[model samples]
Target: MFSFNDLLTINGISPQDVAVALHKPANTSERQALCTMIDEDFAAFNAYQSTHARIPEATLKARGIMASFVMTSDGRMTFVGLFANAGSQPFAQAGPHVYALFVRMTRKMTGPDEVNGRSGLEALQNRLLFDLSRLDTMSDLSGRLIVQDPGARNYMRVADCTPLPVVELTKEAQMTPPVPNWDALVLTAPDLRKLPNSWRVQLSAWRGVYLIVDRCDGARYVGAAYGSENLFGRWSQHVAREIGITKELSQCDPAEFQFSILELLSPAATADEVIGAERKWMRRIGTLEFGLNT
Candidate 1:
């Protein structure tokens, strides 16, 4: 029964004079743009909102908007901040009639690195992304405030100046769970890419042998990490490959693959030692003759 503008009123905002902007990016490139912004690229995110295709004042005035509430897709339409429409100007040589909308924001949630959600992976800050447990109250501005999904895609609209009703508040808080034990992880390609930074840091610090199993037919791939990024770097690159892993798995579907750690090795482990462990796993798992390692 609690609402968004109600939270605004508590913050001294007169909802009637405000417009609420919902940013739920659906395309891959747009999603990635937003992801980077929330994680470590605040300046870029700021510039992104500050510059935009201009919306005529006549159009804005027709709607009685004098201020703005911009929310990004973090699992739900979680409010990131409020801005004043300082007006617009041309952006580079980009052709006519085009303009940029500059805004000054007061952030309400914690920083992206302090968060552990899918947003860093392009599905997350468009990803307040996780646990807006404080929705009905405004005592703590550090936690994100959730607005009920408006159910429409009109990115900008007049605010009701009251509570925008929510169906369920906690459903959208999906995120990485406590980093988990290494052996307990069984990640999909999408899962790997969307993991939070803390987990990636841990993976980056270790040298290890890992496994990729094709879910489609139980075909396996055995790989080792001893170079720069260690397990994190190697695995990230593996997931990032568009066509396939090595030339051997080219004809297979990458989406059907699941990733996991087979054995953890010391960071000081030599490349030969790592590969030696890899060979052992290959023999144990029968991955060389029947799996995807070439």
Candidate 2:
């Protein structure tokens, strides 16, 4: 049987680093006791191998694309963390593949205890940081993610064991052409939450007419921002309330909402003018009859 050390050697991690990880205390309470965890992770991994025959061999040959399987034990979700080429090359040279981003798929949690930090996927990276030492190399790719919730099952793995579809992060996002106008910028609720600081600065500078389109039901809500904080401030209010002006908005999943600017007005725009534009939009879209506007 391959002890953790033998597994590390097969995964291309150095002996010196392996020794440090095993003996070192990751934190005050938990020492780096990864030997058994690694075994368990692999056992889960191997269970799927009957279908993915090449996973074990391919993982050895592929140098990039590290992965983590974050499974919620309660059968609510299965989060897959895909690093472009995490272990195939040196850390510094891996380019954008070095950073980690998490995706949450499926049911919502009832409390913060379900996740290590604040509820939602936003805190996923922070949770991953707690396991930084174990994720140091490809050998530790499949470390178990332990959290306060027994319902959460988090494990990191090489991309090879179960090849997941890659979301192009680095090159494509950079290559995306900039939106020429604020009216053209469309944002999802999650995108708005992750809105860049620079973009927020520009948005905060003006009042505007905006639209909230619910992707799930094709409902539309027209609203205006003419307050002192301007469009950015108004949107921040939406984030704060986490709902829209209508009863429909209050009930619908925020993930189903898409926000966009209809028209941008000067900072001097009055509240009446903003509201007038909003009403015009509602009328044009028949939001009061068919959508969420009240």
Candidate 3:
């Protein structure tokens, strides 16, 4: 029979503080009215629970995570919530858990009206779906339960499963004669800043070394690196050093460039083995190829 006001009191939060944090109108009179509405809503929920007694324990547990509410410019209000599991604790501690919930509530509260034109109810449903989706994505739970649903096959058919577009590389100048039966190495670095945010590093790394090249526009020669913490920096340095090498070898020269990391294998792995794995993974999840001019 615990109400939201009671929960807030237990958590040491006040309705006025919630309104101010949520950026609700600073008008004291309006703030008091909203708090009264919230109290009434909680009282009704408590009455409903007394009659039905059907609320799930998980739902009650989730309520504890919502710390505040925010009113959007369009009059929609959102409830902010948070969840903490072991893996996320480190990142969460870096910021205020309550503030994060406020941001979430602000985003959800401002959306369009739903069925019956009830903003609060619709926002709550959307928040629930958002939380459920996060749990589903992170959990190791298989789709077996979903598959058992009556319309499972129909649902699967409606789901889109398309391949990502591939970036094509042209062989302009073969400065270094291709090694006979050499394995192509693919490496990936998710954090490369210069490359298009969408562009992932895909190259082969073998024997503690890897080659990177320009996949887009093909205007630069590529370089290789070994045992570097900032592969992007090392690759850039290689490009600068090799700018002259490419110009000297191929008079019709484009600038040499460093490759980003998309796929990298430690020195312990064989080049051929890494290339094979790279090809398999790329086939499944599309990757860009880097030119290894250096």
Candidate 4:
């Protein structure tokens, strides 16, 4: 029944001072609300998370968010980083409730710029940022995270959080858990644009028969991916076009399409093998007779 707050205390950080930034970018709107840090550079991603917060400065300073327990929400949460918070300034260039910059504290909240405005501490402050590797040493709380659902608030006080136990922990959390394998893969039209790198890599090397169903009316399109383009590239064509490939789907919004794998093939699968599978799926699914396939 050990909790994340317990982990914080063991590291010598009081539960009272730290506010965990629970990043739960489960959908398109959610991802946009949070800075899209996953696509950012290595060190820069943590820097982005450090400076970013949707909570107002008053609440941040009032509750004393000296560090952020960076975790992403996508079903099983993954711990990303533990960043020491210094102080935060309003995001003048952006909308309200978002901070533009956060002055960061060192690992133990001891540093010069920890006061909000100071010089020459960026490199030193960045060193204070710790990733999952540091957390893994505490207790083997990595494989398959099992904590109580961290509710809707994106940020919470560690003091208020101590009562909640980290139900179970076994392995380090991936930036994203390995997305469902191809058999379980289902992609929203919006996901294609912001596809997780893990998913992009899987699709990049896969050649397969795929299906696109209109989210609005359930009209399905069976297609195939082969040659140099692969499934990733082929799926892109659906969204990249203003008008879809078929006469039926062209009348419907492309964003209304849902993409999924119909049948997977090896990278060594032949063009004939791919197209033949595509035909098999189309016939079995009745795409040619009643669906959007052309």
lDDT of 3 by residue, 1-294 (tens): 323344335545442222111325444323322333333333321111111112332232223222223332223333322222112112122334433343333322221111233233332332212121112221221111111111111111111121111122123411111212224423222112122211112212222223344444443332333433334445433433323344322432223223333455564655466556545544443333432232
- C-alpha lDDT of candidate 3 relative to the true structure: 0.29
Question: Clashing residue pairs, candidate 1?
Answer: 73-126, 73-127, 74-126, 74-127, 75-127, 118-124, 119-124, 124-127
Candidate 3, residue 88: the lDDT equals 14
Error of 4 at 189 (Å): 1.0
| Model 4 residue 135 lDDT score | 29
Q: Give the whole-model CA lDDT for all candidates, comma-separated.
A: 0.56, 0.44, 0.29, 0.57
Error of 1 at 2 (Å): 2.9
Give the TM-score of each candidate: 0.58, 0.44, 0.22, 0.71
- List residue ranges in candidate 1 displaced over 4 A: 27-36, 50-74, 90-143, 165-199, 213-219, 236-259, 265-273
Q: How are the candidates ranked when ordered by TM-score, highest leading?
A: 4, 1, 2, 3
- Candidate 4 — worst ten consecutive residues by lDDT sum? 105-114
lDDT of 4 by residue, 149-184 (tens): 567654544455544467656555444445678888
Candidate 4 lDDT for residue 205: 91
lDDT of 4: 0.57
Candidate 2: deviation at residue 92, Å? 23
Cα misplacement distance, residue 227 of candidate 2 (Å): 1.3
lDDT for model 1, please. Answer: 0.56
Q: Sort every candidate by lDDT, greatest first.
A: 4, 1, 2, 3
Each prediction's total of clashing residue pairs, residues at least 3 apart in sequence or on different chains, is 8, 7, 15, 6
